[model samples]
Target: MRYVDFTSEELWKQFLPGDHLALDTIVKRHYNLLYQYGCKFTRDAALVKDCIQDLFLYLWHRRNTINETASVEHYLMKALRRRLARALSKSGSMEGIGFLEFKDVAASPDEQLIQQEQKAALADKIKKCILQLSRRQQEIIYLRFYLNASAADIADIMQLNRQSVYNLLNDALNKLRQHTGAYFKPAMALSIILLLVLSQL
Candidate 1:
């Protein structure tokens, strides 16, 4: 059935019909993206992974009752966000919920070693700057820039009004600029700042 060739919505439709292959395909396609997004909300990789597993299981079990959706990625992300929040809330340990730890990738060879080291240092700096923002601000930046979510999509995912999303995003960017002043160029673009932030992810 070439499940790999199916669009997300197509896979979703197949899944609704109790097709295990379709469900597996859906998981394989979205797992990495979901895991990365989930990690931005919490540092516990295990917890993020568990929530994603549970999310898919819940969807599979409730396939008959779940309505169709135009955007499966958005639906899954919103569900996972809610699930993680509930789990964290019940544990009463939301203190370390906004940081993404830097991942070290090995340099290919000595010639590029210096360049890789510089990039790693910059990524670490951006990660620290992001960690200093409020949880909501970090999330807003992640959604808007990392995911390239439109203001309306972010409003839906974060459950904020579009205007509020704009306000929060503006405030977050302002704070990021101040925090990054030591390393940032006076005219560096916000998109570039975010791209550097994503380098570690």
Candidate 2:
């Protein structure tokens, strides 16, 4: 059926009719993204893995009741978040989740040694600066820049008003600028910052 050429919505339609291939394609395409997003909530890799499995199982069982959607990724991310939250809450150990952790950014071997060192240093500094933000601020930054999600998508994922998403993103950027040292070109600085942050993911 050339699922590669199918839009996510089309694949979703096929999945609704109990097409195992379509469901498999959807899982293969989104599993990594779901795993990464799930990690943002908890460091427990096993828990995240189990939750993702459960998410897919739930979707498969309820396929007949699922609604049409333009973005399968968004739907999956929102569902995963809710499922993880509920699991954590039930365990009464939700307090430690949601803190941002830094993964070491990889350096290109082709880059000059000095240049690589400078980038590593900058990434370390940015990681420290981001850790200073509130959990919500870190989450907003992650969704907006790292995930490249539109404000509306973020609003739906985070359950915030659309305007609130914009406001919060702006405020998070401002806080980042305030906490991080001055850069002559704010726009360029932001690009570099997001690049370094995303590299870890």
Candidate 3:
């Protein structure tokens, strides 16, 4: 049968009925988005890939029992987020070991060198900033920017109200700005931003 581009609900109907094509499309649609979010959650490419693989397999096995959700993207992300968070919590992996498989990052020698330097700087800042975040806050940020999730979508996925997601994001961004004021160029301005963000949160 020819595959059709159907709404998520239709896709779910097909999926639960064991339509292999539907399952294929579902995986293709969300794989990259899911993987990127997974990477942000744990910074380990392999683990994230493993987690995604496990998730897809679990979904395949349980499709008959899976209920329809308004947004499949949100559901997959939520499931992936929960799994990654649980894995991280259980392992507490802090050994500076990377989990991502930066595929053939082919670049000119100069470009590669510049990329490495930038990556190192960003990594340092991220490590410091991440350590300052509450677990909930960290999850929110990861879901929002990394997964490109909308506030409404995230609120649904995270089981929080829309206002709560905004508040959490605001509070987390403020904390990060305060802690990383050194990079923000002006301590006074950064402080003001913090106060504003805190107020919003």
- The Cα local distance difference test for each model comes to 0.76, 0.78, 0.66
* C-alpha positional error of residue 115 in candidate 1 after TM-score superposition, expressed in Å: 10
Best by TM-score: 2
Q: What would the per-residue lDDT of candidate 3 be over residues 128-194, giving only the tens digit for each residue? A: 6656666667667655654567999988777789999999889877766677555533434333333
Colliding pairs, model 3: 44-99, 45-99, 45-100
Instruction: Write the number of the candidate with greater TM-score, choosing between 2 and 3.
Output: 2
TM-score between candidate 2 and the true structure: 0.87
Compute each candidate's TM-score over C-alphas. 0.78, 0.87, 0.60
Candidate 1 TM-score over all chains jointly: 0.78
Superposition error at 113 for model 2 (Å): 14
- List, residue by residue over 1-201, the lDDT tens digit for candidate 2: 699898878899999979989989999999999999899888888989999999999999999999889799999998998888888888887753464555656644325323566666655666667776677777878887787889999889888899988887787677666766653147556666677666767
What overall lDDT, based on C-alpha atoms, would model 1 receive against the true structure? Answer: 0.76
How accurate locally is residue 98 in candidate 3, as Cα lDDT from 0 to 100? 27
After superposition, the stretches of candidate 1 with alpha carbons farther than 4 Å from their true spots are 95-129, 178-188
Order of models, best TM-score first:
2, 1, 3
Cα error, residue 171 of model 3, in Å, equals: 3.3
RMSD of each: 4.1, 2.7, 8.9
